[model samples]
Target: MNKKEKSLLAAVVVGVGVAVFKYFTDRPKKQSIKSLFYLNDFSSISKNFSKEEIEREILKIYKEEINLDDKFKAILFLTMIEGIESLEKYNQMAQETLEEYVKQSSKKFLRINKKKKTGRNIYRENFYDLIEATCEPSSLKADIKLGIEECLNGNFKKGQDIFLSSTNSDKNTFVSLVICYFSDELEKLDKSAHKRHVKNALKDDKFLFLKSYIMDKNNMYKEQIDLLNSIEPQNELQENLRLQHLLINLIKTSDIENKNVNLVNEMIESFLSKKHETTNTVLNIIGISIEWSIINENIDFVKKISDMYLQGDIDTYVDCRLYVFTYLIVNFVEKLSEKNKQNFNFMHLNTDKVEILRKGIENNETYYKLYVYLGGETKDISVYKKALDICITKNEFINIMRILLVTETQNKILQSNK
Candidate 1:
């Protein structure tokens, strides 16, 4: 109980208190930096950090990786973040480092090689593989983050080019570019080269829907069917791909040129044979197939789809709702017999379902034209005006065309009647 012993005890207690305070204060700061180690983590930089802090932290992690491949990937991730030009300095640093590494590696290879000139070509191939072929497939997911911004802006061509230009482009980017190609946003390229690229992209199992869609688009149904037949489905998803392939084949090969009713019935029967669990992809195919049937005047197919609609087989899917609405208003409803018309009118009775349809029309640009066309059928000038206003606000050319055509046609008919 002496004064000296009490002073020493107080000093020990104060030292421990300071150390605990320091640990608590520094822990979060260290954790915040450590949490941003991976590319995916870096992709979602929080607003808590300034742009400069993110750049500094990213560079710190990039330098710590100590290997050329890892460093390059980290830089590539930074470059893929949209609208961040400040990070390009890091990309230049990476490029310079890569150049120096390649020079040193080439020198080492040349020293042991019998043919120096051919060794250079071999080195280039290895370099390409090192940067691209050996990188993790998800590295290109960063490119998708940037490309999505362009896609959202309706600059599909720019999005496609961003994907195409990425050295680490993988299945995701390839599939995204395929969507751009189908949209006719991409500039014309060599068709054989494009097909070869598509074939390579289709080898990824995740994009089976894209594979079927491509086959349908290109009228290469026979080739796709043969391919699907060769590979036994490993899972339920693969099985669905096979079913979609067969359904598309039936639609593609039908004698639609001659208005063959039997063939139309056969197609409808084939589609309905598989009680498909309405996945988004399956629903898309259903909508597209029914659209084709409608365009070809397949009344039997329309009736089958209408029956499915009434049964709520496809009530949840946006694509099914869209195409079914289009079919009913344009081709099916007016042609229905009195009894069928009564049944058809029942679809309008579901207030909740009608709300879903209205929400879909409000949110989806694809639905706008169909909504305008339906408005035209009603001879509602106000609906046409509403559609035109929306098209103008969104700068939707196709929707504008639909609105204009429908309005003018209706006006001409009214003039004739008067």
Candidate 2:
């Protein structure tokens, strides 16, 4: 009886051990979403998936993981999406999501009266009031929205005040404040207050560009260049700052013998030597180079850089393109004598180039006036009249009046010469 029992017990123990080891070894390991995506490798990882595919994958992960909360998932999803989408688009979507989350959670916690209406209706009716009651006065999202609204409404002083007063002061907040301070509406603020705000803004390290810009604005070229050199450019912002430094340096040494020209050549060669993955940086370089060429009185160089910009596959904003185009037209007109203006030909401007210039000027009243002025200066009266008609239709009257006055004076001077 002892031998049989011992043998049976040994067999049972061995079988149980085998079963336990197989069960442990064969079970699926719980993979971390973070480890799978590797947030640090976002650009490389995200390029493999389209926006819709990324959205689906994120949803799948969110549903599959019970421990991972919605807020955390949302944050991770946002980080991944940002690598794929433009920064402006990412910021807009993320801010909207945050606003909705804040609104919904605030409604639940603040005990806003639901009345007899359904949840959706109740939220719709009391949304703004609920936000006002529940949002922290210091909330970053709230402050950003408020500041943006104020700026859009042409109340730059109010916007600047809101941005400066933001309790959650960070890089974004400081950036917003700097933008407001630089806006055309800053004229509405007291001169002393505006100066004070600019001084206060220059104190932040993240605002090196703003500080440099202010220095440049005040004609402190050496200081601006020094500040720009002090910055270690890691991204597009810092890179652009470096470019600005180069351009400002060129401007400062314009009167010197060959100094600005040599600097321009160096800048052009430096940019061309690098393999730029981003078109924006390259386009920026080309645009500034064109300006540098004009400053150096190298009309041929201007034409060459303009051709490069027009022919490149760079997808830049309308404003950026318009800035380059405006400079090109201005320089071209300035170089042409009145007798030569009559011989000037618009035939060289191809449809694609015209379309690009038109797209850049569309909806931009200030730019439209500049285009009109350029046309008038070049004796393209037909183009000027057409642009004027469009401006009249769009009710862009203020700049229209200024453009008309300038054009009329120019016409009178030409008539007097005749």
Candidate 3:
């Protein structure tokens, strides 16, 4: 071969080597970014990941120059991470990012609409409405803020008047109106006017649950039942509505032989049978059923169902485990009450059962009621102290104190009478 040809041949070989090296070196980075995209895509269904793991993955991805669409997606995924270890600092950051993105996007949308104004843009209308209707405090007016505080303080009449007087009758105003009506503030207002407001607001599915609640209150049982039945629950809030509907029906049918009991039983079985049912769903069903049984004064049924839940045949989801334990404690107290016993013997429970109750008691808010029941039944002041220590909310602590006082007074009266 000629020397020039040899030099060209070596150059070709070197170029091929560099290309191969680049492909191999960059492949993993590309794959890592691709994997992050997949994680973001399937985040809604990705239940196996811990919150810390998700946070780490999100932080790693955030360092990259992700496209706008994927950035929004990552923000959404971050929102779904449960029990965020940083007390939701990450969630707050995500929310700020989302708000800024929405602001920029809104400006862009307006520019587009102005340039192409053939007619009103429906997308712009809906998107802007959504941004305005979000529960962010920054999106609300001062009057709306005052109205919310008034409603919370039980000044529903004042709150409702303020909410209705606002020129901005967005979704939150409608919600406040419903709250006022439910609180009976509208009794002084014109019934026709209240009905009109509700009718107009009923277009949003967000109000459907409240509408059903109104129907249930007004003895429009069939209408409420139909409304609840029409709803296909896609998330935990909707599932709660479904459970509430069932509970209302159970309450309406006062007959001891009501067929709704069988329906509830079937629902419980169906939910337990489903491997995909969320912990929140399972807990809702169980809690509702327990409340139903209590309403019916069916203590025996409570015992039966509580025992079934505590037997561990069904895998107890972590969030629901405390609830199950609370139910077990309630059942124990009720059984003791039935036998006219003042205190329960811990020796009766197996070691594992005792451990379960102890672990449950360690979870303050989740097992708050259990502490109340235990304190009342055993006349244990220490139990009340434990409950009060973990109680953060003023209303809950006040309620617990009232319970303790009443129980103590009852005990004194009983001892004196004896």
CA deviation > 4 Å runs, candidate 3: 1-165, 168-173, 176-178, 181-206, 217-220, 233-240, 251-257, 276-278, 290-317, 320-361, 366-368, 381-406
Clashing pairs in 2: none
Q: Where does candidate 2 stray beyond 4 Å? A: 1-141, 152-180, 256-258, 274-282, 295-307, 312-374, 377-403, 410-418
lDDT of 3 by residue, 315-387 (tens): 2425434444454545555555546333333222343443444444544233456566566556777777666
Residue 146 CA displacement from its true place in model 1, Å: 3.6
The number of the candidate with the highest lDDT is 3
| Model 1 lDDT tens row, 1-418 | 8999999999999999999999998785544643654423443364456666766776777778876555654555455445676656866875665554444433222111122121012222211221232243355457754764464444555666776677655444354435433333344445665666666656655444455556665677777767666767665555555655565566567654354345445655776765666554355456656776667666556556655644442334434244345444435456656665564533533334334445445444333554554564566666655544333112343345434443543353334334
TM-scores for candidates 1 onward, in order: 0.46, 0.47, 0.43
Q: Give the C-alpha lDDT of model 2.
A: 0.50
Residue 218, model 2, lDDT: 58
lDDT of 3 at 5: 100
RMSD of model 2 against the true structure:
27.9
RMSD of each: 25.4, 27.9, 24.8
lDDT for model 1, on a 0 to 1 scale? 0.51
Error of 3 at 349 (Å): 4.9
Cα lDDT of model 2 by residue, 229-320, tens digit: 77776665457547756676666667764676677677676665544543443455565666666655665555544444444432444333
